[model samples]
Structure formats: C-alpha cells, structure tokens
Target chain A: MRTITKNGVRIDDTFAEAFPMRGTALILTGPNKRWARQAAVTMTGFATSVIGCGCEASIDGEVEARDTPDGRPGVRVLIFAMSSNDLQTQLVNRVGQCVLTSPGSACFSDLVAADALKVGDLLRYFGDGWQISKKFGNRHFWRVPVMDGEFLCEATTGFTKGAVGGGNLLICGADYEKTLRAAEAAVEAMNEVRDAIMPFPGGIVRSGSKVGSKYKALHASTNDAFCPSLRGMTKTALDDDIGCVLEIVIDGLTEAAVADATRAGLAAIIKLGPRNGARRVSAGNYGGKLGPFHFHLKDLLA
Target chain B: MTLVLTLKVTPPQRLDLSVLLPHLLADKSSKDVAAIDLATTREKITVGDLFRIRAGSAEEIRFEGGSERFDGVGQGLQQGRIFVAGDAGINAGRQMTGGDLVISGNVGPYAGSAMTGGRLEILGNAGDFLGAPREGELNGMSGGLLVLRGAAGRRAGDRLRRGTILIEGDAGDWLGSRLIAGTLIVLGRVGVSPGYLMRRGTIVLAKPPALASTFVDCGQFASSFPAVFGRFLLPESRGAARLFRAPLRKFAGDMAVLGKGEIFVPA
Candidate 1:
C-alpha cells in the first residue's frame, strides 16, 4: 500500500479496538454556572477508570439555562461503570456527598428514559423528617428543605451501553514536541464531537501501558518499546529516526461516535503534521482479538 | 372560574368533605370544582347532583342545599370562602386555618374544633362545644372567629386559646370551660355554670344565672352591646358580618378555676 507520511512519519494501517460498557449521565444545576461547575468537578474527580476509581466519570460539558429543566446553568457529567449496581452506588454517593452539599446546587438526570431506576428516593432521607417528594410528569424529584431554600435532586438516572476505548490513534514525530503538537491537534478536532470523550489528560497519553507487567506485583507496565530513551536498551519498535510517540484514547456511547471521533482526529493531526515538526498517524489494536470494534484508519481517513 | 364540581346524587350516606377543602381545590376552577368525583357506598358519584353550583369569579364556593349529615365541611381549609345554604353536620369547619365558612342553619356537634385561623358563622343553633378543642387536640381555635345566631349546646367555647365566639341565643351548661385566652359572648340567657373552670378568657353573659355558684357575681356594669360584639365577633365573621351590632352585658368568671374569662349577654 502507498503510505501517507508527513515530515517523515509513517501512517499505520491498523485501528483501535473498543469494548461496550454501560454509562449514565447526570446534570447538576446551581444558582449560577460557577457553583454548578464546582459541584460537577468535585463529583467527577478521581473518576478516570473503573479499575481504581470504581467508575469512570467526568464533566462532559456545560449547559445553559435553556437546556435545563429548572432554567438554571448546569453541567453535564458522564459516569461509566462495569454494571448497573455499581453505577447506581457511585452515582448516589457522589451526588449526595458532592452536589447536594454544594450551595444552591440541584442535581437532575440529563438522560430521560422510562427504564431507568432512580437513586434520589434513598438520599431524600437526609431531609430527616421534613423532606418533600414531588412527581412531575413521569419523573420523580426530591426537595430536601435546606437553610437557603431547597435542594432539588432527580430521583433516578438513565443508563445505556457505550463503547469504551473507541477511535484511538497514535501520533509519532521527529521529536517529543512535534508528537505533542500532533496529539493536541487531534484532541482539538475531537472536541465537541457528540457522545465521545478522550479519557486521558489533554486527550493524549504519554505513558501507554501494556496488558501485563513483567514484575510479579504489577498487573500492567509501561510500553517501553515506544520509549525514545529505551530505544537501544529494549526491543524497540520505533525506527532510529523516530523520536517520540503519543496515544489518543477515545470513548463513545456508540459506533458512530467512534467513527466520527476517528475521522476528526485523523484529519486534524494530518493537517497539523507538517507545520508542527510533522508526524505520522497510526492506531492501537490487539490484532483484532480484544474488543468487538475494529476501526480501520485508512477507511476512517478516506 | 377555574373549575366547578357539582354533586350528581344526593348521597344516601353521610358525605365526606375532608377531600373537598379549598387548598386541595386550588387548581380547579369554579366549573371544575363542581365536577369532583366522589365515592358513596363504594359507588362513584359526581358533585353536580345534589346542589346547583354557580360559577363565580371570586375564589369562593357557595353550596345551596338543606341536607344535614355533612361532616368535615371545611376541614383544613387554608383560604377561600364556603357558604352552606342550610344546616350542617358534625365537625363543620373543623381545623380551619384561614378562610370563611358560613352555615345558614343549625350545626351538629364539634363545629370549628381546633381551628387555627379563620372565621366560621352559623345563623342557627350549634351543638356541643362549638369552637372548642377536639378530644385529643392540645390547641383549640388558636386564631379565628366563631359566631352562633341561636342557642349553643353544652360546653361551648371550651379550651379556646386566642379566638372569639359569640352566641345570640341561650347557652348550655359549663360554657367556656378551661378557656385559656379568648373571648366568648352569649347575647341571651346562659345556663348554670357558664364559666366553670375557665383559666384566662373573656366570657360575657346577658343575664345573671340564678345558681351562680361556680361564677362569682362580678357586679353589674353599663356597657354598649354593639361595641362589645363588634370587637370580638362580627368584624372577622365570614358570612355573618351583619349580625354583631347588638347590646350586651359582660360577666367575668368561672371563679372556681382562675376567674379570668367573661360571659357577655344582651342588655
């Protein structure tokens, strides 16, 4: 195959594989956007992965007053868990501790569906004996009387299966600076894409981990094959001219999310390749054996 | 003219008015209010049958019927006006907080029991303990007005805290018993032991009782009747606002307990 390379970097032929996981999204509103963001950030903090954090959660985006049910500024937070039970537990605990405790903040379900069971029924007991429950339409809400006024929280959240580790791509360049620039371009392009998120910090991961570790105590270890400093010491997969590599991991709620993110990310990185010390693009995969999704980079870019 | 509900059938059994309070009927207009679905003897019945409901723009309800056995007629009514064309049943205007209820005819037992803030008026006689506390309630008629046009049954205005009750006709025994801090007026003759065991309320009786054992003779005094009744009974009266302009005599006692509440009678 005739390969496309910008500034002497190779574009790999493979694609990233992703698995399906269940996720839920919550919307938190406050007297203003600042307090809403504060509550949302606290609720989603340390919720990067299900392995360590019991769930993967983050502030998906900011919502305006018109987008909310109560006509207040809100922030949307997406939470992912291994199962329905885990999602419910983490959601209840985080909302009760973080959002409800924040001043003038009210939490409500962003995703409205009939099948979802709510969690606010249990947390409403915090009102002690004075709590009031209201049902509007099909959704139930709890009004916990507080000192300032009332803290209104939705009784339930909605959940659906979403694709995790979707549309991932790797950036390789002549040096670390070029590689980071390419990653940043990819991230910027992927921003605002619907139902998709780059879970790593800045949408790029410098320390990519392999499946298992050589040490008995560790389950996973760093991919030394891609490390520039260890090029001569380990079985290096990078060419001698290749200086740095960065990986972008994506997750989406569906197949379309993965495909759209992949397309945008590739286009952005390709556009920025020559100007930013240039780079080639590739994707991560386990030989099509790990996940159900297989995103072919050539098909995506085309 | 929100919603109106009219009874479709004259209930064979006693009708329950607990569900018909004004606060519960807020969202319904006068027309919709006349269409409330009620259950009688395990069968469904509508409100448009028994009484003719006239749609009014005012946030008040008028019932034109002479049937008795209406219970809890204005229970827990926080606001709005209710007028009964004829006599009422047990517990009429019970536990009312803020509203006006008027019964044109006599009322059954326990009218205006435990009323917190409102005004209730009965043009005819009233049963036992009118404007008194319920059997288990600690507070009684804390803030409201009750006026009876005719005689009252035994123990009228018992245990009242901070409201006013006026009786135009005769009163039964043990009137204003255990009254803490309210006003009770009897424009006609009071039966024996009018102010028995009263703590700190004003009870005015028209004629001095012959027995007069429990109540000490507080001495004769010249006082204007309309001023006395107007101060305590009529101004706040919901449907009987025109009946408070009469002369009265004031007597203070149930000296057997604390000697505070007075009994006022017509001069």
Candidate 2:
C-alpha cells in the first residue's frame, strides 16, 4: 500500500482500529436552548473513554423545537459502552444527575422503535411513589416531580447495533501551537457529522494511548511513537520535523458515521494547508486485531 | 361494506342487545344476524323482529335510527368499529376490551362500564355513571378512552381505575367520584363535589369546579401535562390541549377517603 500525500500532508495507508460497542442515543429537551445545552454538556462531561469514566458520551447534534417533544429546543447525545448493562448504568446515572437535576429539562430516548431498556423506569423511583406514567401515542413517559417542575422522561429504548468505538486519527505538526489549532479545526468539523461523538475534551485527545502498559496493573499507556518529547528516548513513528502530535478519538453509531466523521476531520485539517504546520494524518491500528471496523485513512480521503 | 342494522319497528319493551357486537355481527349474513337471539322485557325475540339487518362481512357495523331502547349495544367487543347514528340505551359499551365505538347521539346511563380496553366516543350527552362501575362491582372502567362531545350527568367516571375520560361540555354533580386512578378532563363547567372520594387521579377542568371543603388547595403552577395531553388527543379535540397550556390551580383532595387525587383548573 502506497502512502498518499495531500498538500504535503501524508495520509497513512493503515486503518483505525475500532472495537464493537453498545451505544444508545438520547434527546434532552429544555424550555430553551441554554438549559438544553447545559444539561447535555454536563452529562457528557468527563466521559472521554470507558477506561476512565465507564462510558464515552458527548453531544452528537442539536434538535429543532418542531422536531422535539414539548416543542422545545433540544440536544441529542450519543453514549457508548462495552455492553448493554454498562450502557444502561451510565445512562441512568448521567441522565439522573445531569438531566433530571437541570431545570426544565426532559430526557427522551432517540431510538423509538428499538427494543427498550429501562432507563426512565428505573429513574422514576426518584419521584418516591409520586411519579405518574402517561402514554402519548405508543410512547410511555414518566412524569417525575422536581423542584422546578415535573421532569418528563420517556421509558425504555435500546442500543443500536454496529457502533464502532475508538476510531482515532493522529495529527502531526511542526509545533505545538499549529498541532493544537489543526486538531481544534478537525474536532469542530467532525462535530457537524451525524451519529458520532469525539468524547475527548474539546474533542481532542492529547494523551493518546497504545494497547498495553509496561506495568501489570495498567492496560494502556501513553503512545511513545508520536510523543515529541520521547522522540530521542523511544522508537518514534514521527518524522524529524514533527514537533507535536494530537489525536482525535471517535465513537460512532455505525462504520459509515465514523468514516464520515473521519473524512470531515481530515478535510478540515487539509484545508488549513501545510502552512498550518500539519504534516501527516495517521490512524491508530493494532495489526488489524482490535475489532471488525477498520477505517482506512486512504479510502476515506479518496 | 359496512354491516348496517336499522330499527324496523319501535319495540313495546326494552331489549338486551349486548350480543350485537360489531366483531360478532360483521361476519354474519343478513339471515344469520336476523336470527340472533335478543332478550326483551317479556321474552326472548329474534333480531329480525326488532330490526332490519343488511349484513356483509367487514370490521365495521353501522346502526341507524335514534332508538332509545337498545341496551348493552357493544358489550365485550374486542375488535372492529361500531358506529351508532343516534341515541342508544344503557351500557352501550360495557366490558369492552378493544375496538372503537362511536355514538353520534345521546346514550343512557352506564356507558363504558367495567370496560378494560378500547375507545368509546359519545358525540352527544351522556347519562349518569359514564365509565362508572356497576352496582355491586368493585372496579369501574379499568382501561380504554371515553370521550363525551356533550355534557355528562352525575357520577361520571365514578370508581374509574384507569383510562381517560374527556368531557367536552358541563358535568353534573359528583364528577370523578371515587376515581381509583385515572384522568378526567372536563372542558366545560362542572357541578358540585368534584373529585370527591377520589383516591388517586387527575381531574382537569377548564373552569373552576366547586370542590368539597375537604380538598386542599396546592397553589397555582405551570405543568407540562397540557402539552403532553395535546399531543395524545386527536386533531379534532385540539382545543382541549390549548385550554391546558396556561397555568393551573391544583388542589389535592378527597382527604375524607385518604386519597391523593388532584383537581386542576386553569388559573
């Protein structure tokens, strides 16, 4: 496989190694956009990776008032975990703490037709025998009384299949400032794509890790291959001119969504030109053993 | 085609027409439906003696004529649609489990009594005990929807355990009396002692209702229920949803019965 370069930026012939994950989507609507985004941001905060937070969640997109229940502004969030049980636990905890506590916020399951899991059914106990269940059409909702008002939440929705977790892209640049801006551009562009979330802080992961650590207790360690400081100390994958590297981690509802997001991120960085100091875009791979989903950077760019 | 049953002669006495469910008669031929047995005040009479049956197999049955002596018209109906062009006698949809019963005119007492599921629509006035339990029964209508386009008499939704009862016009005394758990929406005025003895349920009134002194007022507040209710109601009844969009004065009552039922009026 030949490495293709676009505008002096090397596109790696390798593919991103993504593993299978159970994912569910939620729509949180509020009286206004501010509150809706507030609850969403809070729910997805600190949820960069399952290794650290037991889930990888972030705001996937925004919803118009006409499209949401209660005709209010809303935000859509996607959360991915290793299993359905893990996803359910994280969903209930995050929605209970972030959404139910937020004033005028109501959470709804995004996948209406999917087999249901008990998210709101479990959370309704917070009402303490005061919760009322109402069926609007075929969807059942629980009205849990809160301090501000009643928080209306939908009960039961399931995870969508084929969600690819840990699709990654590494941006190598001449300096730290250029690398940061390029990564920022990539994150912003990818945020526009549907069915995916970056999950990392500002959608950029600075401390990208490899599969295993030298310590027996740790399953992952820092990637020395692209670390600028470790260039002289370790066998590095970076060229001599590369002084900084930033990785964007993606978890999407489908392989297509991950590919689309990857394309969006790369296009944003490529549009910035080599003058922005971005020299290469390489993906993290584990000799094709990570999972079934392999997003080849070459095919995505082509 | 719709299986039509038209009253041929005014019966001298009332008739028990509970077995004339739409699902049951839909598949019967005209001759077969006419031979159906119906109990009258005097003795059992074939349906051919009281009505003209024009039958064909279909999920729908239409009953014409403003007859007031046909009792128990849609009992135990599980599926299909029944449309009554005029008034009907007592217990129009008793024990109905599933189906849609649309009565375009007034109905006698005990409509939708002990019903477990389905939708019963009364386009005109309703007699007493609408959606209420029978004289000796423990539970009333447990499930299904009862929408009254006109006024309702006393004891409407009495002892109702579940389901929705929407009254587009005024309701007489004892509205929602002894409701176990359900929702009653009254779009117009309501008479005295509303929500009395209700254990747990919601009574939404467009106008302030005369409540018993035992009911406690819980201050005025805005709720998301109206919006939710509006989304569930049909397009023709959208006004009921609009009426609920404003702030409501909530009162939790029936303390005399150790109940937690609530009455909501537009504030």
Candidate 3:
C-alpha cells in the first residue's frame, strides 16, 4: 500500500467506491424548532444503512422560519434507497408514521427533482373525507385534519435518479478511543458539507463489513483484514502499531458532493495529526467493480 | 413596443373586441390586424374603421380609450398582455385560457366569464355576473386569478368550477351564488345572501355580510390554513399578508343547495 504523510498523519493511496442510489429530501416544519427537529429525528430514526433499515437517511440541515413553506422552523432530511420504487415506498411510510404523528408537524419537499413520489397524496387519506387540497403557484398541498388541528403536507416530494452512496473514510490509530475521536472530527467536517449526510449513529461506525460471510445465508460480514485481533490468522492489512480502526460513511446527492465531503473529512483528520487522532487515513473499496463513481484518496487530497 | 389602438368613433351598437386578442394579432402587421372583421350586432365595422391602430409588437396590446359598446374585450387569449385604459363592455375576458387582461376603468356585466386560465386585473368596479358563466353554461372561471380593486355587481362567481377571485372592494347581493368550487375573497362588506346555492367553495369577507338563515354557523375554527393561505395572498395584496388575514367566523352554507360551501367573515 502507498502512503504519504500530511498534517502528521499517513494518507493511504486508496479510493472509496460509491454506488448509485435514489435520493429524496423532505422539509419537516413545526410550530417550534423543537417539534420540527423531533419530527425529523423520529422520521430518520433507525435509518442508518440500507441493509437492515431498507434506507439510509439523516438530517441535512435546519431551515429558518422565513425559508419554510409554513413560515416555521424546519428541518431538512435526506433519504437514499437502492431504487426509485423502494425510495417512494420508504418515504411515504416514514412520513405517514413519524412526521404525521408529531404534534404541529408539517412536511414539504426540499428537492425539485424531475421524479417525485406522491407521499402526501397517499397520507391525506388518513383525514378520511375532510382532507382539503390546495394548489398555489404550481405547488400543491394537502391539509389533513388531525388531533392537533391539521397536518399541512405538500402533495409530493421530489427524488433524483442518480445519487452517490457508500463513500467512506477508514481511520486507523494506535487505539480505539483515539481512532474514534478522529472519525468524529471527520464527521463534524463532513456535516458542514451540503448535499451530503452521514447516517450512522453518532456519524461513526466501528463494525466495517466486507462483501460476504463464511456462512451461505449471509451476504455481508466483518472486515477481518483491518481487525487488530485477527492479525496473523487471516490476510491482515493492519500494522503492529495500529490497534483499532473506525469508519465514517457518506451519502450525497451527487458525485461532486461526495468528493467534496471526502476531501473535507480527510483534511479534518489530517489536521488532527497523529499524536491527537488517527495514525493513518484509508478508504474502502471492492476494486471499483461494483460502482460507477470512484473517489481516490490521494486525488482528493491533492 | 406596445401595440396602441385608439377608438376613433363611438360605435352605434355593441362591438365584439375579442378579435383584438394578442395571439391572433401577434404576427400580423397593423394593416393585417386592422383588416380583420369585427363582429357587431347592429353594424358592420372592421378594426381599421373603428380605431386608429398603431404598428407595434403584439406582445402587449393597449387600448387608449374605452367604450360600453365594446363587448368580449379579451377572449381566447392564450398569452401576452391586453390593457384597456377605460371601461370595457360585457364578457371582458370571456374564455381566456392564459395571459394578463388589465382594465383600468369599470367593466360591464359578465367580466372574466368562463375564463379557464390567466390573470384579469380590474382597477375599477365590475358590473353584474362578474366571473360567471354564459347564460346556458354550468361552469365558469375554471382556472387562473382575478384581482378586482373595486366593487362588483350581483351573481359574482356563479357556478365557478375552479380559480381564485379577489375583490378589494364591496360586492353586491347574491355574491358567489351557485359557485361549485373555487375561492372568492372580498375585502369589503358584502350584500345579502352571499354563498347562496354554492355546493363547494370558499368565500372570505373582511367585513360582515347579511347572511341568509339557511346557513349554519360552524363556530370558531383553529386551523393553519389562514396563515398558510395568507402567504399565497401576500403578493396579490401588495406584500401585506396581514391585510388578508382576519379572525374568521365560518358559516357552512348554501344549505338550500348542496350545503358543502363555506363563508368566512371577520369575527
């Protein structure tokens, strides 16, 4: 493996492979910021990776009162799934359950993409026959009556056909705690990048996985190559000085966004330096055969 | 440059000015436009005989004067703008699918009748049957917006299937009567029996109306629609959204008909 030192941390000359995903955004607004954030958080809950959650989602950012449709504080959430059909189903189900139930919560579309899912159109049925549909200036919305007065939701939220997912940064250090600290710093920097979201818990993942497990039923298992405990038993990629490695996965609406986020993350980790955070920074890939988009670490740093 | 048409003489009878539509005259020269025959009930006069037509692009057509005998002022207009400096006769914007029709002075009966799309701005008062359908038609003003800065005559929004009508002035009796579905907001006081026979629609009045006994009061409603709807009316009200929002006392009415319509007056 090729490595270069930057900001006192070794940079591995590897790349992160990202696959295409269907991406969509939702603007959840409430009478107050607290409720708006609550609805957004509740809707994005348990949506870490698409493997088990069926989707990957997180809060993109916060919108001020003036920017939201209802003139209230709002939270923008992004969700990514494997297919357009899957994305439509996931968003409708999530918004119906989480955002609709939240007090004083309303939802709108944050994206103006060509392809859109009629999420509110389906959810308005909950109001029975009392639902009112309003259209103004080419935009349509539904007012569904609920216990908290009514839930105002846009008729549809747009989705994009080509989004980038699985862009990751693997931070290796002498120990677990320091490596985790490095991943956290990288995530903080990544969070500032627009059009990208880190959906993992605390924006950090300790269990990185490879393609397949030893068992026939499983399609994925642990990455033993980077595990410190499985050193000589398998083909190990870790050195004697490296005791733990952590990862931060990023999903973005565009390839350029993913690249920008990866650069910001790598720059933040390298800025932390070896003494305080990570000893080395690397990326995960499957020889780039699985995905069309590739982000080389050295290319990003340069 | 705007196409200017000045009335040279007062026609003896009602003249159909619908022939002056922008789309029809867009590619035509002044001479060609003037050559078009104008329909009249009592006289035969081409556009050239009735007006002094100035050669200009058809994107914006302006009438230097107005006449009560000019009927169907802006009909079947798909795009562009039509401006009338003075009073317009009946059916001022009949069946207009799109574009802007602005009348600086008062308009006669049947203003904006059967218009499907576009914006009609009347700076002065409107006569009877404003935004209503033709005599035999069942639906009127299917789409688009109409902002009237002055008062309106009787039977406004009659059988309106869809669209929005905003009158900043008072409305005569039988306002929004027989309205099927649409929004009609009158900022000033309204006469008796508003929302009469309306099956489904919203009629918001800034002042109280002489309501009919058939209408049932729905009491106070606490909904997000007022503020949400206020945002949509902001630009139409010169950016003063608060002027369009008021504590509304909703009355679900036209019980004499389908009984699904609602009228909102200031509480």
Candidate lDDT (C-alpha), each? 0.71, 0.85, 0.87
Q: For residues A1-302, write the lDDT of model 3, one tens digit per residue.
A: 98988988999988999999999888899889999999999999999999999999999889999888768899999999999888988999999999999998998998998888998799999989777676665677888878867788889988887789999999999998889889999999988888899999978888999999989999999999989999999999998889999999999998888999999999889888888899998999999899898899999883
Which is the winner by DockQ between candidate 1 and candidate 2?
2
Model 2 chain B weakest lDDT span, ten residues long: B221-230
Q: Which of candidates 1 and 3 is the stronger one according to lDDT?
A: 3
Query: What are the candidates' individual DockQ scores?
Result: 0.02, 0.39, 0.51
Compared with the true structure, what per-residue lDDT tens digits does model 1 show for residues A1-302? 24656434457777787777677778788778899899998998877667677877766788997677665788887777777778788888888899878888888787755447466787899989555454422455666766665677777877776545445787778887877888888888887676677766767778776777878988768888778899889997677667888988776666887789889988887777555744567676677887888988878873
Reproduced native contacts, each prediction? 0.00, 0.29, 0.29
Q: Write model 2 residue lDDT over B182-217, tens digit each, in one string.
A: 788888888999988998888888986567898898
Give candidate 1's TM-score. 0.53
Give residue A199's lDDT in candidate 3 (0 to 100): 91
Q: Write the per-residue lDDT of candidate 3 for residues B1-267, one digit (tens) a residue.
A: 999999898876788888888888878988898888786754577889888988898889999999887788998888999999998999999899999999999999999998989999999999988899987887988888888999999988888878888888889999998888888888887888888888887888877667899899987655656677788888788422564455667788788987878887767
> What DockQ was computed for model 1?
0.02
> Candidate 1's residue-wise lDDT over B118-158, tens digit each?
78889889999888888788766777778788889999988
Query: Which consecutive 10 residues in model 1 chain B have the weakest lDDT in total?
Result: B220-229
Clashing pairs in model 3? Answer: none
